[model samples]
Target: MNKRILTALLLAAALVVSLVGCSSQTGGSKPVEDAKTQFKSEMKFYGSTTLAPVISQLSTSFNEHYVTWDKVDSKFDKKDIAIYVSGAGSSAGVKSIIDGVSDFGMVSRKVTDEEKAKIEGYQEFKLGMDALTISVNPKNQLTKLKDSLTTEEIKKIFAGEFKTWNDVDPSLPKTEIVVVTRDIGGGAHEVFQKAIMGDTKVRADVIQAPSMGALVTKIIENENAIGYASYGMVNQNKGKLVPFKVDGIESTSENILNGTYKVSRPLIVLRKGDMLPQEKAFMDYVVSDEGMDVIEKLGFVPNK
Candidate 1:
C-alpha cells in the first residue's frame, strides 16, 4: 500500500471509531428484538431494593435476548453496555437520581413536594402500587395493627414501655415484645413512621435491621417481634407470617385499591428532569401490558 494512502485510510478509521464511541457512550452496541440496536453504555439504574428481584430478573432476560455487553469485570457483568443496576432502598434510589448518580430511580411512594423541587424538570411515572404491611410471626394471635397508632402508643412500644404481648391487650399471652424496623431513610419506613408515630422518632430501644430480609427474619424467628414491609414481601412469606388489620380491614389487594388500605403507596421509576430518548423507551416498556403482568404477579398493583 502506498504510504500516503495508508495514512489517509488510518485517519478515516480513527474518525469512525471516535464517532461510534460518542454515539454509544460505551464501547459497544448490540441488536435488540425487532431489529433495534440499544447502545451498550454505562447506565446505572438505582432505587427500591424491593424492585431488585423483578427488575434484576427481567434485566437479565432482556440482556440475554436483546442486548450484548462490553463486560468490564465481575460484580459488574452487564451485557447491555447501556445500563447497569444498583440500589439500596427506594429513598436512596430517588436521592441518587436527584444527585445525578443514577439515570433512573425506583421508589415505593410518591415523591414528596420537597423532593419534587430538587430536580427542576422532575417527572414521576407509576410502575405499580404497594402497601405498607405490618407483619407478625404466625404464632402471634394479634392479627394486625390498628389503622393508625396514637403517637404515644408507638413511642411506648418502641421505647420498651409496652414490652409484653399482654401489655398491648390482655387477651394475648405474656410475651416479650420487640420492635424491628427499617432504617429511617427507606421510603416505606418513612410512611410507617409518619403514619404511626407521627412526628415522634423511633424509640432508642427499637431494633434497626439493615434490610427487609433482616427485619422479616427477626419477626419470624422471634415470636414476639413485629416488623413492616411492602405487602409483596410480607405475603411471599405469608405461610410463616401473619398480616395485621389496620382499622377493621385486612391487607388484601382489594382493600388496598379501594381506599380501605390506609398505607397504599405507588411504586415508581423516575427519570431526571425530562427523560432522554433511551430512558423514555425503558420507562414505556415498564408500563406496557407485559410489564404490568409482572407487577401484578409480584403482588403489586399495576398502574393500568
Candidate 2:
C-alpha cells in the first residue's frame, strides 16, 4: 500500500462527512420553517358580562377540540386556537370593537342603529334570547300581595313615583321600596329602558349593580329590593328570589321563545370591518347547532 493513496482515501472520507453534516443541518431547519408558516394567532373577545359566561366556556371547549382554525379556512396555520374572553359590560364591548381593541364584542341586547352606524362593515350574530325579569327577594312583602305587575306600574316603580310597598299597593307594608339597576353602560339597563320605561327615567336614587350576577345577589340580600335581571340569572337563583310576571306573561322558555315575553332581548356578538379567518371561524362555531346547545344549557332560549 502506497502512502499517497492511503492519504487520498482519508481526504475523500472527510469530504463525504462534511456533505452529510450539511444535509443534516438543512433537513433540521426545514421543519422549523414549515411550522412557522402554519401558526394561527390569538384573538380577544370582550364585552357583555351576561354573555361572558357562555362565550368563555365555548371558547374553552373550542380550544380543546379544534387544534387549528380549519373549520373555516383550511389554509390557516395548524396552531392551537386561543380566544381570550372577558366581561366589561355590553357597551364596553361595542366600544372595544369600534376602537379596534377587540376582535369581537358580546351584547345581551340588540345593537341600536346609532351604534351600528359608527363601525364600517359592522356585522352582528344573534346567539340567543334572554328575558329581563322583574325580580325581588322571595321574602319581599310584594310577593305576598301580588303575583304580577302591569307594565305601567313597573314604569312608575322604577321612575321613583312609587316609593314604598304601600304606594305600589294599598294592602302591602309601608316599607320603602329599594330600586336596583345595572349601570347605564349595561345592555340590560337599555333593554329595560326601552321595553318598560319608554320615555320615563329610572329613579336617580336607584341602586346600580355592576353585573347581572351582582344584581341577583343584591336582590337576594335585600328583602325590600326590586330590580330587573336576565331570566337566566333569575332562574339560576331559583327559590332564592321571586320573578314577577310582566303583563300576565311569565318569563318561561315557552314565552320567551314565542316572543310573548315583552321584556326579552337577544344575545348578540359583533365584529367590524373585514372578518379575520380566525374571527369568522369562531363566529361560525358560536352559532352552530353545538353552540346553540351551549346557549340552551346556560338557560337562554337558543336562536334555533
Clashing pairs in 1: 40-81, 40-82, 41-81, 41-82, 68-79, 69-79, 144-244, 144-245, 147-247
| Candidate with best TM-score | 2
lDDT of 1 by residue, 7-85 (tens): 9999999999898877665536742335234343555778777776656655665555546443333333354545577
User: CA lDDT, every prediction?
Assistant: 0.71, 0.87
TM-score of each: 0.75, 0.82
Over 67-170, each residue of candidate 2 has an lDDT whose tens digit, in order, gives 66664467876666778889889999999988989988988888889999998899888888899899999998789887899999999999999999899989
Candidate 1: list runs displaced more than 4 Å.
Answer: 1-40, 69-82, 141-159
TM-score (C-alpha) between model 2 and the true structure: 0.82
